[model samples]
Target: MTTLQWTPRTDAPRALVVRDGHARLGPAQATEMFLPFLEQAGFEVQVAESSEIYADRAVMERTDLIVQCVATSAISDAALRGLLDAVEHGTGLAGWHRGIADAYRNSSDYLQLIGGQFVSRPAAPDEERGTDESDRSRCYTVDLTDEGRTHEIMAGLEDFTLRTEPYWVLTDDLNDVLATTTYAARPDDPWHRPITSPAVWTRRWGDGRVFVATPGHSLVVLRDAHVRAIIQRGMLWASRPAAAA
Candidate 1:
């Protein structure tokens, strides 16, 4: 990743977002958009393409938030363990879509740390890289959980429709699910079941707060007014003191 150009507010918190492995997701658009988004929220941001960013213990210690938007299998065990240690000691961990949960598929330490894993999804169509709106992703709805209605990060957010990948996520009992989506049976994925999976969630890894929004496969979805708000709030929410969580 090249150096991101953004002015920093001295009073703002620091965030490190790692962008690595992504299948069909647009890393370029995501990278381009997220810089201004986090900076505008008062985050002194560092963007790295290497999963090895996890190993920079000094950076991890200074960072208030760590957002990994990388591939599922590219991160190393040492790096994962380093991140896990940092978060346990106080760093916040977060990711949009596969960047958080889907990362480190073979490492139980990574999965255990994040509290969820990306099991599978509706088949993503092949594409030339583009924004979410221009791409026209498969449509789905995002509905808040009962608890989400009053949740500070979700305050004023409501159920909304989006044209994006409706993930069929697998989660553990530890996840505090905030929002979800129901996938209707389709000819392409016809089953007797109408699956409702977590679209947004927050969980604790020791004292470290963790947030995941599994809806972003593009800048289009990520750039949505609601979704962008959720991502910003989610990162800020996680960065707060654990006692407040």
Candidate 2:
């Protein structure tokens, strides 16, 4: 998982890459993809398999940004406080898929920091499972908001379709919805019609910025040239000293 071909920036931005929690959710896989991308994109990244990074004041202080790929995990009260203090003071926070939105279901403070929470998958009806739209594979389209089409993170990226999980999330208006996906009620689904959710977005936590992309459940979807480019830029921007847009 090490590829040093990509050079770091002359003044490299330091990033703490933290990943731990649900395996099927792919924190490891995300680290595998993101670490190399960060190195090449000119970031000096520190990898952490545990949530301890949240409590390391020295590390949190010097770190320019945090890329959290963790899912459904808990942090020590102190660690959560420290992480929050750091972010409130301006350390950027960014993540993708289940990493940011779906992690720490019980941490309301954490949920507020990210401005959203993963509720249910809005399962399509299934007689066997007795629920509809429960993580079934389906086609979803990501359409950019007018702002998103020209935003720095999404610049030059066109609307695209991805076949993946349409995560049913509960988010407030605080999030500047960047891109969204629409899902029609298949005959098997519970709803008789369609529904849409934010596919990509950015939010603010105190002085810090939060960037998230909600549609990366599998490699085929995440590796798409457009998707990769957007994430690369988002990660870079989350940290300071990013490459020019």
Candidate 3:
């Protein structure tokens, strides 16, 4: 692992492109609500309505932090290559909920890169079934692991609750699990066992860093003071140090 020096400001303006075509939430919601959050965090943000531009190598190269708020969708081979290349060369990548975990579902290479995927949930079936954003449930407790407490990204954080989706992820190669949520078995479900699912994690592929959190199913989750702080630190932590790059 390489140590990244903390800087007052990032080198280039970061871009947060919300892919409207594939997102469960429409473009207006993402652009109006989500983009502002990044801009407020001090990044020069741009919201791309479509993913077509991602295919251009030059466009991908110029980006520093690429935040994909899109759900599962097909991407051109060129686009996939471009995004992967940017990360390999030291660009940071961060996303929460299905924006990333479920994005590019068909690409095994993509899944492997991100470290996991959304398969199914047993504890909160009703919340999963509801399409209305308001119908989503909240207020779940997350346990931060030892690894999580030591990391700079998790600095000054403790077990916190967020009004967001409780994620049941299918993962194997998570480098470090910063936080987790416990699930109790329901009568309808076959598995009656309790399991701890990773709520936040970080992985490295080549030179790039990938940080993921399964909590951001709604704007409320994103707006939580603790959640916002974690994401802000995560973006900075995930980016390659300027010297390393």
Per-model C-alpha RMSD: 6.9, 6.6, 5.3
Expressed as tens digits, the lDDT of each residue in 1-245 for candidate 3 is 22222223445566646465454544356445556666776567766766666666655655667776678777777667777777777778887778788888778878888998888654455444556645546457888999999999889999987656676788885567898888777677788788778888999887789998887776766778777777777777775565653
Lowest summed lDDT across 10 adjacent residues in model 3 is found at 1-10
- The candidate maximizing TM-score is 2
lDDT of 1 at 146: 98
- For model 2, residues 110-157, the per-residue Cα lDDT tens digits are 898888776767553343233453457666578999989888999888
Collision pairs in model 2: 9-42, 123-132, 123-133, 123-134, 124-132, 124-133, 125-132
Candidate that scores best on lDDT: 2
Tell me each candidate's TM-score: 0.82, 0.85, 0.82
Lowest summed lDDT across 10 adjacent residues in model 2 is found at: 1-10
Model 3, stretches more than 4 Å misplaced? 1-13, 16-18, 26-42, 125-138
How well does candidate 2 score on lDDT at residue 86?
70
Candidate 2 Cα deviation (angstroms), residue 133: 10
Ranking by lDDT: 2, 1, 3
Candidate 1 local Cα displacement, residue 45, angstroms: 1.9
Clashing pairs in 3: none
